[model samples]
Target: MIYLDDLLAATEGRRVGPSAPARFPAFCYNSRRLRPGELFVAVKTEGGDGHDYVADAVQGGAGGVLCQSPPTNPTVPCVVVPDTQLALFNWAAYALRKYDPQVVGVTGSTGKTDACQAIAAVLSTRHTVFRNPPGLS
Candidate 1:
C-alpha cells in the first residue's frame, strides 16, 4: 500500500477536500475499473477527458484523485497538479523506489523483438525476467 503522505510528497500537488485514507491499495486511471481505497489518476486522453469520470471514481470508492483540475465540488481528497500525466509518472517512480531491480532496455531499428527475447533468456538464468511487451501502458 502507498500512503497519502508519500503521494503528496512525490507529486507536490495541492490537496482539496476532506482527509484522505492512510494508504491506497493501488492506483488506477480508469474509474470504471477502480476499486475501493485506490488512487485515481485523471488522464486526458484522446478518447475522452478523465475529468468527466471523477464523480464516477468517487462513487466507485476511490481513495484519492490525482487531477490537473479540481473535480466539480469534490467530496474525496483531490490532489491538484499542473499535469496529471506527469503526476502519474511521478507516482509510478515513487512506487518503484521500494524495490531494487535491475532494468535492461533493448532498442534497435531491426530485430528488436528477437534481441529482447534473447536478453530475457540470458538474464533468466540468474534472475527472474519480466519483459514488457510493446504498446503496453
Candidate 2:
C-alpha cells in the first residue's frame, strides 16, 4: 500500500483540503476508470489536462487527488505539488526504493503479450509479480 505520507515525502508535496486516506491501494489518471479509494493523478498530457477532470474523478469515487493547482473547492483530500507529472515520477521512484521490487521489462515486435503473461505466471508462484496489461505499454 502507498501511504499518503510516502507520497508527500516523495513528491515534496503538501496536503490540502479535508483529510486524506491513510493509504492508497492504487492510482489512476483516467477519471472514467477511477475506482473508489484510488488516488487521481491530474497529469497534463498532450491531448488534455487531467486537472480539468478532477471533479469528475471525485464524483466517480476517487479517495484523493494529486494536482499542480488545487481546485476552488475539492470535496476529497488533495495534494499540491510543484509539478504533478514530476511528483508522480518522484513517487514512483520512492515506491521502488521502499519496496525494492525487481523490475522487469519486456519488449518485442510480437509475442510480447504472451511472453509477459508467461513470465508473470512463473514469477507469481514465488513472488508478487506486477504485470502490465497488453495495451498499457
Candidate 3:
C-alpha cells in the first residue's frame, strides 16, 4: 500500500487537510471506478479541469488525490506534481517494477488480439500467463 504522506513527499506537494495518514492499494482517475482505498489522479485537461472532480472523488472513497495544482477543497489529501500524466506514468512504472511481471510489448495496425492470443497460447505451455481480453486494445 502507498501512504498519502509518502505520496505527497514523493511529489513534494502541499497537503490541504489535517494531514492524517491514509493508504491505498491502487491509483485511478475516474471517480465512478474509484475503490474505497484507491488514490485518484486528477488530470487537468482542455475540456475541463480534474480539480473540479476532487470533491466527488473523495466522496467516492478515494484515499488521496494527485494533481498538478492544489484543489480548492481542503478536506482531502492532495499530491501536487509538476505534471499529472508524467506522475501517473512514473507511479505506474514503479508499481509494475514492484510486481515484476513479465512484460510483453505489442504494437500493430491490425490483429493485435490475435497476436496477443497466439503469444499467450505459446507462453502458457511453459509459464503462468495472463493476457488481456480481446478488443481491449
Selected candidate, larger TM-score, 1 vs 3: 1
- As a whole number from 0 to 100, the lDDT of residue 88 in candidate 2 is 78
lDDT (Cα) of model 1: 0.80
Model 1 worst lDDT run, 10 consecutive residues = 128-137
In angstroms, the error of model 2 at 94 is 1.2
TM-scores for all candidates: the values are 0.69, 0.83, 0.63
Model 3, 28-122: lDDT tens per residue?
Answer: 77787788867788887888777788888888887778887776665667777888888766654664666678889789899898999899999
Steric collisions counted per model: 0, 0, 0
**Number of the top lDDT candidate:** 2
**TM-score of candidate 2 on Cα atoms, chains taken together:** 0.83
**How much does candidate 3 score in TM-score?**
0.63
* C-alpha-based local distance difference test score of model 3: 0.73
Q: Which candidate wins on TM-score?
A: 2
What TM-score does candidate 1 get on C-alpha atoms?
Answer: 0.69
Candidate 2, clashing residue pairs?
A: none
